[model samples]
Target: MTQDNVPVLTIDGPSGSGKGTITRLVAQRLGWHYLDSGALYRAVGIAAGWADLDLSDASALVRCTFDTDIDFQEDHGGEPRIIVNGLDATDELRTETAGAAASAIAAIPEVRAALRDRQRAYRRPPGLVADGRDMGTVIFPDAAYKVFLTASAEERAERRYKQLSEKGVSVTLPGLLREILARDARDANRAVAPLRPADDAVRIDTTGLPIDAVVARVLALMPAR
Candidate 1:
């Protein structure tokens, strides 16, 4: 339900499909609040790693989720700083390692339930733009605009390579490709809130589309100013 006419636009997709960049841009244009749902899971994963907790331990993960201190700060020179348990994990959260950890944690049902309400809390007037694997399907099912952005694994991996490299994070294309494929399978097959498009979602294949074109396509679905 959209509370008090406060609308939401959900941009759900696999990693490196430009969800982060595209969603943030959309929110900025619309003057809406933004939520990066994946970051919540990533924050938990980061906290869990700091405490050395095993991923297989659901109870521990849930407890850690409750105890985790996660908050998003405004962009610091193009990169948003995420505070995880009092430490700035903005850089680490963008790594393939952090992505893998978030995927593992996302598959845990308890953790999903734990974060659902928190994600919903981001909804506010005049609106919200949320990006994540399950934002449209699960977190914000009633969103007025739902878009599933996707790209070929090779293309996405290449994009990730450039992104991380520019940020001084070393990564190889082949390794990223392999990891992306594995994460796709794991996310799609997860028992709870798997990564799949919402039935009503507008699908956009971003394989070779320019960012401006993609953003225009998404915004077209909304009421013109």
Candidate 2:
């Protein structure tokens, strides 16, 4: 059950599907808290890597996850910064390498169970907007609004490549497309909490939609406060 009258909007979709960007914008518009659950997993993955722990070792990963200090802080501009173990890991966590590690660790049932409660703690008064593979299906099952934002592999990859290029990161479109497809398969076929739209979720195909247009669509779907 929810802690109080606080409402929640869960946005779930495969990586590179634009759910992350949409969730943040919706949260800002509603003046609600935002939970980037994938960042938590990515932080754990980074920690595990630093500790020289094998990703296949569930127990080790769980230990590393709990031992790591992960927090999301907002800068003066209100941009979220991911901090892990007192180090700014925002950029590192966003890398495709960290994303792959997160996907692997996320498949571990124990890891998911360990982070479940931590994810729920973000639900404060007013509301919250959460984005992740299982936000709608698992984490925020009772959310007032559930959105599954998706796009074609080609489109998603193109968007990701463009973003990385703007950041001056050297990457190839074909490589990004391959990784997106592989990650999508892994997320959708995982044994526990596989990625899928909640039955009541609103599906939005954002293949060619502009950012503002998509944002407007989601805001329109929100219930009046």
Over 4 Å off in model 2, which ranges? 1-4
In model 2, which residue pairs have backbone atoms overlapping below 3 Å? none
lDDT of each: 0.91, 0.92
Give TM-scores for every candidate, taking all chains together and pairing residue i with residue i.
0.96, 0.97
Report residue 218 deviation for candidate 2 (angstroms): 0.9
Clash number for candidate 2: 0
lDDT by residue for model 1 (65-87), tens = 99998888867476678998888
Give the range where candidate 1 is weakest over 10 consecutive residues by summed lDDT: 1-10
Instruction: State the lDDT of candidate 2 residue by residue for 60-148, as single tens digits.
Output: 99998889899889899878899999999999898999999999999999999999999999999778999998998998898889989
User: RMSD in Å for candidate 2, one decimal?
Assistant: 1.3
In Å, residue 217's CA in model 2 sits off its true spot by 1.0
Q: What's the C-alpha lDDT at position 4 in model 2?
A: 51
TM-score of 1: 0.96
